[model samples]
Target: MSVNLYRFGKTVVTIILKPLFRIQTIGTESFPKDGGVLICANHIDNLDPPVVGLTSPRVIHFMAKEELFHVPILKQILPTINVFPVKRGMSDKGALKKGLKLLKEGEVLGLFPEGTRSKTGELGKGLAGAGFFALRTNAAVVPCAIIGPYKPFQKLRVVYGKPIDFSQYREQKISPEEATEVIMDEIRKLISAHK
Candidate 1:
């Protein structure tokens, strides 16, 4: 990955979003300075990824839907911005392996646990992929919430909750589904708190 390119992209995104949305980022200190980390957030709008990207203290490798890559411009731009395509609603082992590899390299990964955007803007049930990655790599799981509609000039808050420790569960017998709920619950709390 090109560090300079990522920085440039971040700068451009910040310039466009900051004044337009008046974005507010909270609890960014909760992100670990090093090591593999999984950032799980609730998905409401298509803009959520860039919103999280601009506010994040570290570079985030986000998993986007495969369809987005089909767009000519996005196909060229997404990879340059550290966005990888993930096939949703089915088992896409290639994407899963890519995410796992990134995590193992101590990269921060951004994912929406719900698998897709919510039509009602309500938090939905989390899929197990995030939990599986967390368990496999033992990465720090940070629950994030993006609060507010995407209206121009409105206050858009991207709140990051404390890192959830999976050390205990790592040693025990726990299903990925159960672990996912733990992540979702924290995200739910963040949305409620910020709203």
Candidate 2:
């Protein structure tokens, strides 16, 4: 990964966004300092990734839709900024394996559990992919919620909740769908708390 590029991009984004939007981050102290962590947040706007990444305490490697990589400029820039593509809808084994490897290597992976943006800016149903990674790696799952509209000069908040440990469910016969509910519930609470 291009660490320098990621840092540069973050610096630029921060400079541009700080004035346009009143951004606030809460409960960032809950983020794990070491080891793998999965950051599952509710998707609202297309800019959610960068907005969340900038407010986050850690450098987040995000899983973006595969279509984004199809653009020539984005394909080159996305990777430099620590963004990777994943096929949506079906089970993309390649993407899943890549995410698993990153987690095993103690890297943080950011995913939008809804798999797509919510038009109404409300939290949508969580996808099974996030739960699969959480249960498979037994990494800390940190639930995050991005609140407020994307309008200029509007109040925007990114709330990070306490890390959730799914180790106990590893022993039980828990499906990814069930595990997803556990993660989503935490995110829902964070959103409600800020509203």
Instruction: Give lDDT for model 2.
Output: 0.90
Each candidate: RMSD = 1.0, 0.9
- TM-scores for every predicted model: 0.97, 0.97
The TM-score that candidate 1 achieves is 0.97
lDDT of 1 by residue, 66-157 (tens): 99999999899889889999988799999999999999999999999999889999999999998888788878999999997889999999
Clashes of 2: 0
The runs of at least 3 residues in candidate 2 whose Cα sits more than 4 Å from the true structure, single-residue gaps closed, are none
Highest lDDT: give the candidate number: 1
Error of 2 at 14 (Å): 0.6
Worst 10 residues of 1 by lDDT: 167-176
Model 2 residue 5 lDDT score: 88
Clashes of each: 0, 0
lDDT of 1: 0.91
